[model samples]
Target: MSTVQLYAWGPALGAPSIDPKCVIIEAYLRLLNIEYTVVQTNDPQASPTGELPLIKDGNVWVAGVDRILTHFSMRNQDANASLTPEQRAVYLAYNAMIQENLYDCMLYTWYADMTNFVKSIRPTYAKLLSFPGRYLVPVQLKNSAKARLAKYNVEITSDDTTLPQNEKEEMKELQRTGWHHMYKLARETYASLDAQLGSQKYMFGDSPTTLDCIVFGYLALHLYPDLPHGRLRHILTHEYPRLAEFCERFNAAYFSREHDVSTPAEDVPSLWKVLVNNPRGFFSNVKDDIVSYMGTDAPKEKSTAQIDFERKRIWSIAGGVTCLLAYIIWNGIISVEFDGEQGDFESWDEYDQEEVDEEL
Candidate 1:
C-alpha cells in the first residue's frame, strides 16, 4: 500500500514540474521504484514549512528535496551506496553545482527574460488558476525569483524606467556583461559534467545513483525547455555532446518508460585532454571576460508587441494627416476663388454623383 504523497508544483510547458527540486525528488522516487501519489498545488502555504515539493508519509511530513531524499535514503538505503568514498565526494560536488549554481541559472533564464516569462512561464498559471489568481500569482512568483537572484548578486530590472537616468545605460551594460559571464560559467560546469560522466552507465558507473537523479533534474530542464534565452541549451547540445549523450542514455534507461538498459560508449575526455583544454580555456576565458566586463553586448530587439505598437503609431499618424486634408478640401476650408462652380468639385465621383442626381 502506498501511504506517501508528494506535493509539488503542477506541470508547465510539458515538464513534470517547473521546480527543479520537485522534479529531482520525483525522479528519485521513480528511481527507487517507490509507490507514491502526487498532489499538485500552487499555494506554498499548504506545505509544512511554507516551501514546496514536500512529501507526506502517513502522519509525518518531510519538507525540502534534500531532507526528503535523506529520509528515503535512511529508510530504503541510497542508490549511491555502492559508490566509493572518493567517488561519493565527486558526486556530492556535482550535486552541489546543480543545486546552488545551475538552479539559479535556471531561475534567471526563466524570470530575467520577459519574453519567456510572458510566453511560457506566465501562461502556466492559467493551467491551474483563473481571473486575478492567474494574474497575481505569476507576478508574485516573478518578484520572488528576482529577489532570489538579487540575493545571489544577480541584478534584475522589471522595467528600464525604474533606474535613474544616468544609471539605466550603466545597468544595462552590467546586465549584459553579467549574463555573458554567467552563461560562460554554466558552460564550464557542463564541461566538468561531460568529463565526469565519461563512459559510465551512471555517474559512478553500472547502476543509477543519487547524483544521477540530481544531474537529470537540472539537465532535463536545460535540454528540454524551449527557452527564450537558449545559450545554455546550445552549449549543452553542441559544445558538450557527451553530456547530451549521457542525458539521452539516462533517459532511455529510466525515464523512457522502457525496461531495457544498455551501456553505450561514453565520450570521456582523456586526462591529458582535460589537463590541457581546461586550464587553457580558463585563462583564455579570463582574458575575454576582462574585455567583456569593460563593454556590453548589443541590446535585444524590441518584442513583437512593441514592434507592432510602433508600426501602428506610424500608420495612425499617416491616416490622421490624410483625413485632415480630405476634411479641409470637402468643407472648402482651403478654397480659392475659381472659374468653375464650387459644387462641381464634389461631382468628381461621377457614379455616386449621377446616382444622387437621379435620386434628386
Candidate 2:
C-alpha cells in the first residue's frame, strides 16, 4: 500500500499542528496505524476547500477532518465502527456540541483576546510565514475569528483611536461584557465534559474512539499552550482534573512516538519573493480569501434565511474591505499603481480637476 500524504499547519507546543482539526486528523491516522508522511505548510491553498489538515492518498485528495473520516470509513477503517447505534447517536450529539461551543471558546482565547493573540497565537503562527506575510496573515486570521464570534452576538474590537474619556470607559465595558460571556460559556462546557468523563479512560468506554480523539485535540490546545490569560486552563486543571488526566493519558499513548516527528524548521521566503516567483500561487491565495469571505459555496442544505444572511454578509464584507482599503491608501499606508506607475493624481482635487478638464 502506498503511503498517505498529510498536509497540515506547522507543529507547535509539542503537538503535530496548532489547529485542533489538524491535530484530530493526525491523531486519527495514528490511531488507525496508517503509514503517512506529514507535509508542514502555512498555506491553506494546498487544500481544495482552502483549509488545513488535508490528505493525499494515491491520486485522491481529501480536505476537512469530517470528510477525511468519511473517506476512511468507505475503506473499512472507521474508528467508531464498533459503536452501537445508541453510542453513535450520542457521539453525534456530543461532537456537534464540542465543535460549536468548545471550539468557539478556543478561538476566543487565541484570537479574540488581545493579550493571548499578542503573547502566544501571533508569534506561533508568525513563525510559519516570512516577512510581510508574518505580519499580515495573523491579523487576517484574527479578523476571520472575530467575524465568526459576531454570529454568536459576541463583539470585540481593538479600535485604539483616541476618544473622549467617557467613550473609552464605555468601550472597555463592552469588551468586558464580551469576555465574561465567553468565560461563562467555556466554564459550563468544561463542567459538562468533566461530568461526562467521570473516571472513564475515554468519553465512551475504556478503549479510545473518535470522540476521544476530538476531545484530546481540543484539550491539548487548552492545556499545552502557555497563554497569557489561561482562564480555560485554570478551570480544567483546578476544577476538572479528570479531563486533564484523560488528556495526559491520551497524549502519552498516541503522540508519544519513539522518534520525534516534529516538523523540521524550513526557511520561508519573503512576501516579495513569493509574489515574484509564484505570482499565480499568490493570486490563487487572494482568490481563496475572497471566496472564503463571500461563502458562496455554503452547503445547499441551509435554510432560505441562512442563504439570505450569507448574501448580506458577503455585501457587508465587500463594503468593509473597500472602505478599509480606501482608508489605508488615503493615509499612505498602502499604495496603488496603474500602468506600472503610481497614479498621477495626488489628491481628490487633482482628480476632480482632471475630470472637469476632460469634460470641458
Candidate 3:
C-alpha cells in the first residue's frame, strides 16, 4: 500500500499536534495503527477546505477530519465496529454538540479574549512567519477571527470598536457574564462525560474508539495550551483529574516522537506566491483539482440506508411544519371573535362559557 501522508499543524505542548482538528485526525491515525508522515503547514490554503490536517493516500487527498476518518473507516470495516448502533448514535450526538457548542466557546476563549491572543497566540505566529508576514498575517487572521465571532454573534471583547463606548462596556459585561455561564455549562458537560467514563480506560470501556479520539482532541488542546485564562486549565487539572490523566496517557502512548512548538513556514507554499503566480488559474482549477483527487463531488452520492435516512428526515421536517401551521391557524382562529356592538376582541379561552353561549 502507498504511504498515507497527513498534512497538519505541527506539534505543540510537546504533543504530536495542537490544532484541535489536527489532534483529532492524528489521534485517529494512531488508534488505527496507521503509519503516516506528517506534512506540517501553517498556510490555510494548503488544504482544499482552506484548513489544516488534510491527508493524502495514494492519489487521494481528503480534507477535514470527518472526511478523512470516513475515508479510512470505509476501507477498515473493523474501525468503530465495536460500537453498537446505540453507541454510534450517542457518539454522533456528542460529536455534534462538542463541535457546534463547545467549539464556539473555545474560539471565544482563544480569539475573542484579547489577553490570550496578544500574550500567547500572537507570539506563536510571530515565530512561525517572517518580517511583515509576522505582523500582517497575525493581524489579518485576528481580524478575520473577530469578524467570524461577530458573524456568529458570539460575545465580543471590550477592545471591539464597532460599538459606542457605553455599549462596548455593556458588551464586555455581557461577554463576562456569558463566559461565566459557558464555563458552568462546560463543567457540567465534562462532569457528565466523566461520569460516563467512570474508571474505564476509554469512553466505552477499555478499547479505544473514534469518540475517544474526538473527546481527547478538544479536551487536551484546551487544557495544554498556555492561554491567559487559567479557568480551563484549572477545571481540567483539578476538577476533572481523570480526564486530564486520560489526555496524558493518550499523549504518551501515541505521540512519543519529539515535536516542536512551531513549524518552519518555508515548507508551505505562501498564499501570496500562489495567488501572484497563478491568480485566475489557481482559483478556477482548485475546485476541479480537489474533486478529481477526492474522486467525488462536494457531497458523494448517498447509499440506500442514507437515502432512507434523508427521506425520513424530510418527512420529519414536513410533519413539524404541518403541526406548527396547524397550531398557528388554530390559535389565530380561537383568539378573536366578531361582534356587532363591539369591534373584534380577544377570547382568551376557547372553552369560555360566555363565548360558547354567545356562539350558540
Off by over 4 Å in 3: 13-15, 130-133, 147-153, 157-177, 258-360
Listed in order, each prediction's TM-score against the native is 0.64, 0.70, 0.66
What C-alpha lDDT values do all the predictions have?
Answer: 0.62, 0.69, 0.63
For model 2, the stretches where C-alpha displacement exceeds 4 angstroms are 158-177, 258-360
Model 2 pairs whose backbones collide = none
Per-residue alpha-carbon lDDT of candidate 1 for residues 206-251, written as tens digits (9 for 90 to 100): 7888888888788777777776556667888889877777777776
Local accuracy of candidate 3 as per-residue lDDT tens digits, 112-138: 665566567667766765543454445
Q: Tens digits of per-residue lDDT for model 2 on 264-290? A: 223222233333344445445556655
Q: Which has the better lDDT: candidate 1, or candidate 2?
A: 2
List candidate 1 stretches off by more than 4 Å.
151-153, 159-177, 257-360
Top lDDT hit: 2
Ranking by TM-score: 2, 3, 1
Error of 3 at 305 (Å): 58
